[model samples]
Target chain A: MDTFLQVLIAGVTMGCIYAFVALGFTLTIAAAGVVNFSYSEWVTYGGFFGVTLYSIVGLPLWAALIGTVILCVIMGYVFQWVVFRPLEGRHFLTIVTATIGISVSMGALATLVWGPYPLTLPTFFGNGTVEFGGISFFPHNVLIIVLAIALISVLQFCLTKTDIGLRLQATAQDPDAARLMGIPVRRMRTFAYCLSAGLAGLSGFLVAPLFVVTTTMGFGLMLKGLAATIVGGWGSLKGAVFGGLIIGIVEALGAAYISSEYKDVIAFLIIIVVLLFRPRGLFPERIAEKL
Target chain B: MRILSKSVIAAALAMSFAQVAFADDIKLGMVIGTTGPFAGGEAPLVNGTKMAVEDINAKGGIKGNKIQLIIEDTGSEQTGAINAYNRILDQEPSAIMNTTVSGFVLSQMGTIGDEGIPTLTGAASAQLALDKKGVEPLFRVRTSDLYVAKAAARFAIDNLGGKKIAVLRANSEFGNSWLNQIQSVLTDKSVKPVAVESFEVADRDFTPQILRIKDAGADVVIVSGDPPHFVVAVQQLKQLGLTSKVIFSNAGVLPTTIKLYQGDSANGIYGTVDSVPAIDPARADWAKRYREKFNIDSDYSAAEYYDGVMMVAAAIAKVGTDHEALVKEMRTIKDYAGIGNTYSYADKGDGGRSVAIVQIGDGKLTLAATIK
Candidate 1:
């Protein structure tokens, strides 16, 4: 029972990270109408930004996170303007290829700037463990779960119960109709892009303390997040959350109960099974439907 | 003006040709990961190689022919490493120096064998020696993983008084070889590991494995892997509140790896190191010079490669650049003092024979015992 509790905590923490990154994917896909694969780079850059502010510049953690998120939001705005605006109506492959190019370029740029060494970030609670009933839990793990739930709740509330959120969803659902109804489609896309980038930045900051920050760290998370997005059904926010949590739990439980060697294969195996059965993901509904 | 420009260009070309013609410099190829996973560790090796080449050249060269070091980036992938090797081979270097990644070396063995160039690497996989019977030109500059595993296993059982043992390793060729060596060492002592687990090199989360180890009630855990895998594993194990005595492979004790550990998690953990400069005061001058030159702490990985380059130079000085002659000379070198160890290439191309066990405490690695 103690072992199960430990595994569950780890699985949930990992699931939250994946869900956070997947949130970035769903937002851009919904509002921008483009699957921005470069969300991973945003995650990487966000971590670097936080590292610089928190570790290098010696700011408090909260201030650093806020600064990092703001910087990432600006980066997203620029990214959309520079990469997406020029080729907005082009073939889907063209934009995706450009985003891919951005991803590769950002990785190289990170290496050039940061010099390829893994940078360490201090944990929010300073590596203190909370134990109960002979089971141990890292304070950061509990913090991740809480923060993720809070962020998701805040996002859900704004999107469903707020005016600006409705406009954004309207723009995403039918841009032509939204424009006819006096909703600035371009502005809505830009807003969602910036918000998504901010979310990516938050994910990076949250993940930095858990894993050493490396230029290549984003790639693995990106792959997992991409998988989570697909498993949850692309463009579905709830799907992203469920998918991320499920993958993380399966991976933890699989490694614990079965073979550690095939743990990754097990998490991915769920994706295959999901795709085979649900096809649209576990939620089987788009963000537009939720709105 | 045109005539003058043409004359200037002609003079430049003539000087370049004259320099090349007059200077028959020996070429050495350095292939390492400058951009990928191993880049952090491999960077120091590059610095060491560069320092060696520069020092040798400044000392009037090898028999009046200055050494020209050609460095290439491997990108820390097998394909990238192979491409780097091919690029270096285009220069037809007299010898090649590779990184500490065993997988890269294993992948490039066929090419290195075909080229028949004397190759030196710090990769610690014991499989290299097992495969060295047919490959004459390959030499391991660092202590083999087998020896480290043996030393770690023995220290864990005898020194730390550990009874129930757990083995957690990276899922790689190096890790697999180290696990086998540890198991073999334990078997000789009639002991069995309580649990054995492996994680991917890129994995950041290790709680699942730690939980399993805790559940097994292992008193000691032997971790076989490189940094940041080693660094993260130790941190996670500590974070997950495991009080087991932990032993790590050589990479665990590195200054780069040590500096990344969260809080005092690394304080009580034991790790294997190829050399302890503190034990040998003779390394002070070299360490000081390295610090002054590279602006970084001198590590055994760097020292091994530095010694490797110097050893290659000594062999070239003895038998010239002939590959077979140099190989023979390298084998004949006895008690060649280096920054890390007194390297004398063994029959199986293992130059360094000893491993030092160190315990991390108070922000430094304190040498506990030297195992031979």
Candidate 2:
């Protein structure tokens, strides 16, 4: 039972990180007809940003997070204007290739800027632990779970309750129609990129305490998020979030019970099994992109 | 008859010219990691080897002849390592150095012996590397993984006063070696393992393994794997409030490991290391010069690989262009002082296996003591 609880906590924390990255995937797909493969870079941005502020410059923990998120949002706009905007009416392959190019460039940029060393962030919740009913929990783990849930709620509200939300829905549904109705589809796409990157930045910030901030850190997380998106039902926010949790839990259970050596492999194996059985995904596939 | 003889002489001269064009240079094949999950483990060696080459050449090189190291990335995987070794063998380097994979070293040894190339690398952890007749053509530069485990066990028993211990290992050469070495030592000391948990290297979640360890009422957790496994285990340990001390092998206690745990949780951790980070007053000048050149602190991985390359240079210089002679002399280098360490390569068939222990205190990686 204690072992079960331990795996459960690890799964939830890891799943939360995946969910945060997945949230970025869902938002970008919803707002733009193209999935931004470069969303993973935002997580790296968040981590490096936090490391600079908190470890090097010695900012308060919360301030570093906020600053990193803001920088990530701006960086998303830079990508949109510099790379995504130019390919507005190009072939899907062109757009995809361009995003891949962006990813490669960002990866190199990360390597050049940070060197190839791993970095750790200061623990925000202190080095304390809480034990309840024979199960113990790290303070950071609890804090991150709370933060992920809160961000989900906040993002959901912004998507449903704001004027921008209506414009975003109209753009995603039919960019031509949205434009005819004065929705400014291009601006909406840029806005989505900003929102997506903000979430990734947040994910990076929270997970920095757990994993060192390395150039390769975000790529793995991004791939995991992509897997989550596919398993939860392609392009569905609900599905992506759900899929992230599933991947995280499967990894924990596999590491705990099956084999620790294949913990990472287990996450992908579960995704494969889900995909083999449900071609459309565990949930209804949402139309995140349109021709 | 005179006209035919003159034509034959001209043909012979042309044939000799063609032979010179296609002659093979003395290529030193190397399996240095350029990318992948384990890239950090071996990148320093490549850079430091280059520095060693320059330093040697600064003194007019090996017998006034320039040495070349033909390096290829091992990709930090088994298949990648195999492919790299096969390609490097095609070039037929006079000597080779394989990076940090025990399996790769053993696998490539047969080919190395067949090809008649002497390989010096710190990556292989097997004792069999020293067993020449049936060994790989490669020699290990660092302590054998067997020695590392013994050092870990010694540190646990002698310093940490650990009697009952828990073992957490990844299912790799590193982990397997650690488990075998420590298990034997623990048995000799009559300390039964409280619990044993194994995980895959790729597995990020360690909750199940940690929980099993906690349930077994262990006093210390000995880990043998890459930094990620160690980080995940340490983070999960803190999360579960399981304060059983973590005892990691040398590779387990890399600088990257402390960075993974945010330096705070790294406190109170004990592990074996290859070399001290040259911070002592005795080695401060060396550290300062290395940092000034590379913008990074000097580590044992670099120091030892640098020594290996220099040792190769010493042999090559003595033999005066005889590759076979260099290999023979590499085994008999007597009492040569290097970087404050003695090097006399004993063909007892493996290079010496030695270790040091380090303690993480106040978020800094500090040298504790030398563990034999």
Candidate 3:
């Protein structure tokens, strides 16, 4: 039972991380209708940025995270203008290839800037443990998990209940129709990029507490996020959250109950199995009827 | 086969082209990870080897010839390693220095076994590389995981007196070799493990594993994974308030793990390190030289590969480029003072190999005792 609880907490904590990373994926897909494959690089950028500001430049931890996210935002805008912006109106495949190229470039740039060594961030919550009703979690993990949930809730609320959120959702659903309704499509897409970059930053900040801040850290998270997107249904905000958390929990449980070596592989297999059965997802997006 | 035919033709052409009054610099083949997972170990290794060649020429050219190291980044894959070999072979390098991951080395082991290239590996410590299945002609300048695991196990049993241990190994070849070497040693000593399990190299959480160890009455945990993977395990161990001696293997060389574990939590943790971070003034002087050379804090890699370059240079001096002759010369190396270890290559690929148990006593590794 104790083992079960520990695995649960760990799964949720990491699943939250996978969600934030996948949320970045979901946002870009929603706003631009293109899966920005470079999403993982943003997460990696956040980690490298965290290392520089926190370790090298000696900024406060909180400021470092904020600074890293700011950089992530700037990078997103730059890549949009420099790479994705130029390739617009081309085939979706072209855009995806460009995004992949951008990802590789970002990885190389981060590699050059930080060197290939995995950077270390100071444990944000210290080396403290919190015992809750006979179960325990690392204090830092609790912080990450809470932050992920709160941010996810805030995202859902803003999307379903706010004015800008509606405009953004309109833009995602039908950019041409949204533009006819006075929504600036380009701005909305850029907004999505910025939002995606921020979410990636948050994911990296959360994971940095758990592991070393390596340039390659985001690759695994990105793969898991891809699994999340597929399982949750691409561009469905709520589904991304649900699917990401499910993927994380299942992966953790699989590692515990089955072979840990096949943890990542198992998650992908589950996504494939899910796709074979329910091609859309466990929770498909609702279609509004025009009576 | 086509590439090889082309390579042979190119080598012959290059030899013929050399005498056309255009003396192209002698190309020394170099292979190391330029990208992918094991690039961490490969990058610094290449950097040091390149720096050594530069230093040699800065003082004086090698035998009135400027040595040119022609590098090919083997992308941590067997196909890449073979391509690198073919490309460098076409360039007519006198010898090849390879950068390969564990499984990739075994993949090329046959090539070196049949071809008898005087190959030197910067990394890849799978036991099979040195086992009977390995290419007889292959040799590692870098210490094998066999010696590393042996050193770690010997330290735990002899110094830490750690019995009732928990073994947490990663799923990779390096991790499997670590578990295999340690388990055999423990078995010989009649010490049974509390629980043995495996984790993937990219496993993010280890709490379940830790809790299992806690329940099983494990007093010590021997973790074998990459630095990031092992760091999570150690940090998780600390979070669980499990103060059992968390002795890590060679993977503990990453200083980032110490930082992630917070201040002084890594102090009592033992490892078979490359650098005795605490050493007499002589070793400190070597560290100073290393720091000045690399403009970074030197770790086990800096010490280990610096020594490896010197050993390979000694081999060159003793046998002068004959593959069998150099291998024989390396076999006779004895008590040679190396930056990492002071010894010679044994009959197998392990020469000049010595493993020592070092502990982080005051935020820096100090020699606990030699595992002689």
Best by TM-score: 1
Better of 1 and 2 by lDDT: 1
Q: Which candidate is the best by lDDT?
A: 1
DockQ leader: 1
Per-residue CA lDDT of model 2 for B1-372, tens digit only, reads 999999999999999986763343446668866665566677677767877777876777665556677888776667788789888878767677777666766666667677767777776455455553334345557666677778888777788787679989888777787888888998889988887788765456667787778777887788877776677766677777777777777665655456456547678787777666555577677667777887766777777777788788777766744557777788786555554244555646456545788887765667777875
What is the DockQ score, from 0 to 1, of model 1?
0.65
Q: Quantify all predictions' global Cα lDDT against the true fold.
A: 0.84, 0.74, 0.73
Clashes of each: 0, 12, 6
Worst 10 residues of 1 chain B by lDDT: B127-136
Summing lDDT over every window of 10 consecutive residues in candidate 2 chain B, give the lowest-scoring window.
B128-137
Could you tell me the TM-score of chain A in candidate 3? 0.93
Interface RMSD of every candidate? 1.4, 2.8, 2.2
- List ranges where model 3 is wrong by over 4 Å: A257-273, A286-291, B1-26, B76-79, B124-131, B255-260, B274-282, B318-337, B342-349
Please, what are the lDDT tens digits per residue for candidate 1 over residues A206-270?
88877778877788888888888889987877788888999888999999999788999998888
DockQ of 2: 0.34
- What stretches of model 1 exceed 4 Å from their correct place? A285-291, B1-24, B130-134
Question: In what order do the candidates fall by DockQ, top score first?
Answer: 1, 3, 2
Tens-place lDDT digits, model 3, residues B48-117: 6776677666765444445688888665567888787778777766567776366777777767776676
